[model samples]
Target: MNELRSWPGLEGDAIELRLDNIELFGSMMEIYFRHAARLVYNSDEGVLTLERKSFVNGLTEKRQCRLPRLRSLHVFLDTSSIELFVNDGEETFTARFFPHLDDRTILFGTHGHLHMDIEKWEL
Candidate 1:
């Protein structure tokens, strides 16, 4: 099943999460805003994608990196970039983003129920 967890109006430069029973396939996670997504993790393809949409609705092509299957994730966000570390830095993905919206949201989806623990902090 698909699951989405949204955190709006969060002012932070870093985010961390621990997921229990997260399979490498049939799962996806997104960290985004109204205008852009900082990151999208697709387990099935072992890809971590980053994208941005312009103010006029122009969207950038996704940039991808291969990553190992993970149950734990850590993210660092700056004014114009994001850094992702998986499974205690066994793998990593990094990218740049420019978001037009001030509100930020986190969306996590899985084929089945999985327990997740998340935390956010301002840099």
Candidate 2:
């Protein structure tokens, strides 16, 4: 198993990830944006979830896709929105978000070791 945690947090409007072979038992990945939102990928369940915690009700959205086979992922952030793509464009998910947290810190975690490459961009 392997995990990565952001200590100083990430600052940017766009994020990208490249991962390979995610289909392992108990395998999962998550990205936390301070108290604003979170994106979770559950390889075992073939699910991708986005939760807006800054909302009054903590709104949650989910997408079911074969993530284990996906080798790439991307996230684009706007003033109040998020866009996600998987497998270099095989699938996409988009949503609007309102974050309660003012901090722009970010965190990432994985249940198993992944061949991952990450990048952040300022928009």
Candidate 3:
């Protein structure tokens, strides 16, 4: 059962989620996306970024997601887009970009010491 309620994630150090059953989403049939994501924290700038991999016309998305709540960052990645949600959807960012087939990895980058637990999921 690949139900969302049954989706698996982490609670410490880091968090990861992969939507293996995209088929459940009726409108996601033609969508080319993934579930796993990267989590990066820049304590210096108080930003949380969803890193993009090397690909054609690639782009990365960042938000002024402050600290204290920095430890709970969530990033959802698809082959061509990214979605960010934090504090249970309090702060959200919807990012779209172009990606190549080889662009399958998400980068977790930061400038200062900050702990993050990012959950990755795709629809």
On lDDT, the candidate that comes out on top is 2
- Order of models, best lDDT first: 2, 1, 3
Q: Which candidate comes out best when scored by TM-score?
A: 2
Number of residue pairs clashing in candidate 2, backbone atoms closer than 3 angstroms, sequence gap of 3 or more or interchain = 0
- For model 1 the local lDDT of residue 84 reads 70
TM-score order of candidates, best first? 2, 1, 3
Give one clash count per candidate, in the order shown.
1, 0, 0
Least lDDT summed over 10 consecutive residues: which range in candidate 1?
A: 15-24
User: Pairs clashing in candidate 3?
Assistant: none
Per-residue lDDT tens digits for candidate 3, residues 1-123, read 112211133221222443221111121111123333344444445554554344544444334455433423344555555665555566776665554555454332222222323345334
lDDT of 1 by residue, 1-123 (tens): 565655453554444443444444456666553345656667768777777654456657566667755577777766566677777777776666665445455555555445556666666
lDDT of each: 0.60, 0.64, 0.39
User: Which structure is stronger by TM-score: 2 or 3?
Assistant: 2
Per-residue lDDT value at 99 in model 2: 54
Query: What's the lDDT of the predicted structure labeled candidate 2?
Result: 0.64
Per-candidate TM equals: 0.62, 0.70, 0.44
- Per-residue CA lDDT of model 2 for 88-113, tens digit only, reads 78888776776543556577778875
